[model samples]
Target: MTADNALPDCVALRIGLAARALPDTTPAELVRVLIAVLGQPLTEAKLNTLKVKDLKTGANGALSEIDDMAALRQALQCLHGEDDTAAQAAVPTPQPDAEGRLPNSIQVACASNSGERLDGHFGSCARFLIYQVSATEARLVAVRPAPATTRLSIDHSAERVKLIDDCDLLCVLSIGGPAAARVVNSGIHPFKRSQPEDVALLLGDLQTMLAGKPPPWLAKRLGRATGERPPQPSEVAS
Candidate 1:
């Protein structure tokens, strides 16, 4: 049996969303997982009741459904009627000041396949989502697609760097060592994350750091002279 009769497109759409959320999972594999966990033809009501723990405990794959909690939550949320496309559309922006900047804000670039998510790798992300973030606010300033090419190679790293050169930082799930070197050489700090998450959530964490005694790297990014900030507690003598 198929999802044709279930929840008026709910099962199918939710499946697509869940699959998208777990970038590492193919729809066929997810369907198998659903079949095992939810039994036979999945329904919207059944999908709605899906939980992160269910997948984590029931499914096994490259991501293992255990390692990527952020992804699991997103997938479950998608199944639970949380619309990622709608969330992407609802991502709001903060108005910039006359100078086209937010107060004490810095430009940040996120590698993403989806519109406002930090779910893509540096070398292969479809687009870059640029945001202006300060202690109090964050704004989605631009969405720049990668320069189209016949094929992607290390040489394209420089092109990608130039694409977001105006940004202060670049965050991605993965980046080649050479590409990271190039990014640093271009004055853009490259941050590598272990998992994909919402761009807004990532920016919110940055905002919180900005409101406190930020770390050396962050303080440097915020224009504080390197020597002016105190060392992290862990760095001090035992």
Candidate 2:
């Protein structure tokens, strides 16, 4: 079923407000935060795809009837709280590192000027924005979306792709192979892993490339393959 029929109108409005307010934020980022904060239901009972028929029930009245008008008050309440938290988590100022590099995980690219762009990939939306750079490389980061105060206007998929297509870097924690392939094929790299250790390793590799220094380990691998230097660390920054 379409979201219009699945989701109530008030939910749509809340989502719209948040989407419109993100200026440079993407729907993926919002969904990331939303999922992080809201979480999913943990019922062990799995619903079957096939519909069940009540063959034994009396014909006078169906065993169950649709009550589409039932209030979605509870879902709306959850959305409202989550939206607030997500909004506060999205402030875009870069924090400092000892070497003055804006941690590699958050870094977009090295600019001639003192500025850089950061990409935040949340569920269904890919948010990209340039922030005043305080160092050579700023770490790309992702924050969860806030709970909704009102409603959602649309589903997350289309909105996310729109933002990703227009974004510079594709930073995300978890995405399927198909989606990952899309981002890579589009000439955007995906940060599939987002742990601190992974981010540090990624940053170190990128920094080495940026400085034109190839690590022996990487050089060996690349030599065996194409006799060319591996993708520069700056590639990740980009």
* C-alpha lDDT of all candidate models, in order: 0.68, 0.34
Worst 10 residues of 1 by lDDT: 229-238
| Tens digits of per-residue lDDT for model 2, 1-238 | 2212322344444443343333222333333334333343211121111112211121322222322212122223323533444333334443443454332222232111011212222342223432212124534333223222222354443334444442334444345565555555543455444421333344455455545644553333223234244433223222
List per-candidate RMSD values in Å: 10.2, 13.6
lDDT of 1 by residue, 122-180 (tens): 76566788888889988887778764322212266778889998877788887768777
RMSD of 2: 13.6
Candidate 2 off by > 4 Å: 5-83, 93-126, 129-169, 194-205, 212-238
| Candidate 2 lDDT trough over 10 residues, lowest sum | 42-51
Most accurate candidate by lDDT: 1
Show where candidate 1 strays beyond 4 Å.
Answer: 1-99, 152-154, 224-238
The prediction achieving the highest TM-score against the true structure is 1
TM-score of each: 0.55, 0.37
